[model samples]
Every structure is written in C-alpha cells, then in structure tokens.
Target: MKIRIMIVDDQALMRDGLSSILQLKEELEVVATASNGQDAFEKAREFTPDIILMDIRMPGSSGVEGTRLIHRANLPVKVLMLTTFKDTELILEALEEGASGYLLKDMATDTIVQAIKTVYSGGVVLPEDLTAQLFLDKRKTPHSDLEPVGQPVDRSLLTDREWGVLSELGKGLNNREIAEALYITEGTVKNHVSNIISKLEVRDRTQAAIYAVRHGISTTYDF
Candidate 1:
C-alpha cells in the first residue's frame, strides 16, 4: 500500500520541492500540504496521512506544539521534523512530544523519503551525529541520584525479559534494532516496549528513555 504523506512548511518552495520528491516514489503519496502548524493540524484530521513532514519554526503555532497536539490526538500519523535548526532542546522537545523521526532540512531527498518509510514501519530515525550527541550528553549527566537502590525494577508488570527490553529501549534503540541486538522477534520487542511504557507511566519512547535515564534503569552505553 502507498504511504500517505503530508508536508507542513511555511515556505511554499520547500513544500513543493518535498512534494515533488516524494511523488517520484511509487509507494509514497503526498495527500496534503500546509503552511503552518494550525493548517497542518486541520489537514491531519482531514487527510489522516500516515506520516507528516513538519517544519519546526512556523508563523503561528510552532511545529513542536503541533507535534504535541497531533500526538495527543493519537491519530496514527507519525511526525518527522524537518528543519534548519539543530537546536538540541528543540530536537529533544519534539521527540518528547512524540516525533517519530527527525531530519535536517538540507538532508538529501532520498534520506527524507527513507526516514518517512522507516518511521511508518514503526521505527525511529535520528541523524547519526544527533544520536551521538544525545548519547554523549546523556553520559555526562551523573546518574548517582537516579539509580534504584533496593531493586532493579518492579517485575510484577514487567518480567525480567521485559525489563531487559525496556533497558535496551532506554538506550535509544528502536523496535527492530532492539530486536536484532537482543536476538528476539520484533513483535516481542514491541510488546515489551508497550508493557514498559504502561508500567513506567510514560507517554512515548522518548519520555520513557528520559525516565530510564533519570531513574538509572539504563546506562548510556548499554545500547
């Protein structure tokens, strides 16, 4: 099946360029285009695209806020943030708000398309450098206060295997990659991820990762 896509950017030229590039692929379709976050939100509900290419900075509501709104709606529309700024805060905020992927505006068209597909396939895509930076920053923060003293984690809701899966997830590996590293099936990895999310009381993987880091459940180099 063709993957439905929506482009949301203030620049008409950027939107047109992206739309044209995506339209070239046989399995991708551009369902709608929006000028800003608000318009994106409206079109999202109307078109119900499988993926949304969002620009971080917009005239009205920023893409971060828009991502948060769309995520809260639970619309199955994965968000891929495309922007010029590589501001760590913005990137982390978008991820925390439930962005499935992130790419620089200057990325090659092919990479953008691949990112969309990856996210649609229930995976995450982060720029290599950005991923490295995240790990380095996470490592620098001391976890002395966050470590659980008595027990590793409650296994009532999570089995030992599930906690192991969550620990890997805390290291920023997506489902497929996590499965590969753990020598398990993707379906099993996903189930464990879901259980971990519910047990941790987190909204998304990003938040769960943060929780794991803060609680010392996972180490930076574990992944």
Candidate 2:
C-alpha cells in the first residue's frame, strides 16, 4: 500500500521539490499540498492523509500551531516536521504538539524518504546534528528542571541497567541495535524498553528518548 502524504510549506519550490522526490518511491503518494498552516489544517481535515510534511515557519499560521490543532482534534495523521530552522524551543513545541519526527531541509532526499517511512511505521526520526546540539546545550548549561512538556520522570528512579537501555534509546537505537551494543538479547532489550516507558510515564520509545535527553539521563558514552 502506498503511504499517503501531505506537503505543507509556504514556498512553492519547496513543496514542489519534495513532492517530485517523494513521487519517485513506489510506496509513497502525495495526497495534498498546502501553503500555510491554516490551509494545511483545512486540507488535512478533508483529505486525512497518513502523514504531513510540515514546515516550521509559515506566513498565515505556523506548523507548530497546525500540529497542535491536528493533535487536539484527534486526527490519525502523523506529522513529520521538515524545516531549515533548528531553534530548540520550536522543535520542542512541535514534539509537544504531537509531531512524529523532525528532519532538517538540508537532509538528502533519500534520507527524507526513509524518515517518512520510519515515522509512518511508528518510529521517531531526529536529526543527528540536533542530538549533538542537545548534548552540547546540556553540557554548557545543565538545567536541572529541563523536562519534556509532561509529568517529569525522576532519573534517579531508573536502575543502572535501565539507564543503559535509555542511553541506547537516546542514540535512537532499535531493539536489535541496543541488544548488540549492550551484549544482551533482543527480548531482554524489549523488556527493558517496556519497563523504561512505564517508569518514565511516556507513551512510546520516542517519548522516552525525548525524556532521557531532557532529563540528562542519556550518557555521552552511549553516543
């Protein structure tokens, strides 16, 4: 089945270029396009595409507002933020507004396609550069109160083994990768992931990973 996609950007060139590239994949389909968040919201309600490629900055309305609206409306559409700006505040807002992933505009077309597919399959896609930036920010000014917009989890509660699991998650490792890295079985990794999610009070591995980063629970050695 071809994955339905909606492209939202203020620039015609960007929307067109993304559409053209996405059309090359046999498993992808462009269902709709919008110039701003308001238009995107209207079209999204009408078309109900599986995914939306949203630009952070727009004229009429911002992608963050649109994502919040969509999320509040309980739509099934997953949002993948595609933008040039990497402002940490905006990125966090998008995630809090229910974006499935974030990718920069400078990423290769092939990488964007893969990111879409990954987000479609219920995975998170954060740029490696952004991860590095978060780590650097933590080192420069360690905010003890930094937490994702939700009930914060106490990192002190996590067992040492669970910390290892979450560190791998911060690195964006899947169960297999985590198992190999930690010299554990995949089943063990899965169990640890589940426990981590429960302890963190997050919905999925993606949210847990975000929490790990925000709480400084992720170790530099893991990366």
Candidate 3:
C-alpha cells in the first residue's frame, strides 16, 4: 500500500512543492496539505494519513504543539518534522512531543521521501549533522544519584522489563514498536516507560533515550 502523507507548512509554496514532489513516488500519496499545525491536526483527524510532514514554526499552533496534540489524542499517524531552522531545543521539543523524525528543508528530495517511508515503517529519524549538537546542547546529564555510565546498573532500580523498554526507546522506536519487539502489551510498555523515566529521573523520554545511548544500553532487535 502506498504511504498516505500530509504536508503541513506555513508557506503555501512549500506545502505545494512538497506535495508535488512526493506525489511522483509510487509508494507515496499526498492525501492532504495544511497551512499550519492546527489545520494539520484537524485534517489529520479527518483524513488520518499514515504520516505527516510538519514544519517547526507556524503563525498559529506550531509544529511542536501539533505533534503533542496528535500524540495526546492517540492518533495512529507518525509525524516527521520538516524545517529550515536547525535549533537543537526545537528538535528536542518536537521529539519530546512525539515527532517520529526531524528533517531539514535543504535535504535532498529523495532523502525526505525516504524519511517518510522510514517513519511509516516504525522507525525514527533525526538529522545526523545535528544529533551531536542535540546531545551536547539538549541532552542533560543524569541526576547525581543515577548510575555512572559503564557501571552495571542495579536491576532493583530498573527491572529487566524496564531495561528492555529503555533499550528500545534508545533506538527511537515508538511505544508500539517497542511493545512488538518485547512481545508486551502497549499499556505494559507505557507503564515500563514511565517507570524507566521516573527511575532514571530524566526530564522526558527524549532524555531517557539519550541516557540509554550514553550508557551503551540498546536493543539488538532488528527493526
């Protein structure tokens, strides 16, 4: 099945341009286009596309808020942020709000199209050149009491199940993917993720994922 897609951007030219370019791919279909984030959400609820290409900044209801809306509403669509700006804080905020990926507007057209397919297949995407910057700027060091990296983390602090979830989260799989990987209920995965965050004392799942990477705790499960 072709991946259903929605293009959301403040600029009409950008939205239309992306829609035109993406429609050429036999594997993709541009189902809808919205001028801003709020409009995107409304259309998302109505059209329910498999993926959304969201722009970070907009006049009313930015992409971050739009992502949060879709996430909190439990929509089935994955959001991939597209923007010209390279702000690390916005990247973290978008991911924290449940964005599946972030892409620069300057990237090759094929790269953006592949990113949509990647997110549609339950994978996560982030700009490579900026990930290091994100880690250095937005990724916080774990709390003082948290176990130091390379040390064996106490199982008591985080159970084996929670560890599994953490590892999957580190790989940037959403809850559904993690549940499928671990053979657990999504509800159970959510519970484990909550516990992972509380036990790790990180600000959010984004930070928790970063911690998982920094600690070399990651899943070997094939994507």
Question: By TM-score, highest first, what's the ranking?
Answer: 2, 1, 3
Per-model TM against the reference: 0.76, 0.78, 0.70
lDDT of 1 by residue, 1-223 (tens): 9999999999999999889989999999999999988788888999999999999988888899889889888877889998764455676678888987688889888888888877787666665445555545544557623233122454476677776776666565778888998899999988888887888788877666655544455553322
Candidate 2, residue 205: the lDDT equals: 84
Best by lDDT: 2
Residue pairs of candidate 3 with colliding backbone atoms: none
- Residue 47's lDDT in candidate 1: 97
Q: Which is the leading candidate under TM-score? A: 2
In model 3, how many backbone clashes occur?
A: 0
Model 3 lDDT, residue 41, Cα: 91
Candidate 3 displacement at residue 179 in angstroms: 14
Candidate 1 residue pairs that clash: none
Least well predicted 10-residue stretch by lDDT in candidate 3: 142-151
Per-residue lDDT, model 1, residue 188, is: 90
| Candidate 1 stretches greater than 4 Å from native | 132-177, 198-201, 209-223
Give RMSD (Å) of candidate 2 vs. truth.
Answer: 4.4
TM-score of predicted structure 1: 0.76
Segments of candidate 2 deviating more than 4 angstroms: 134-156, 159-161, 173-194, 215-223
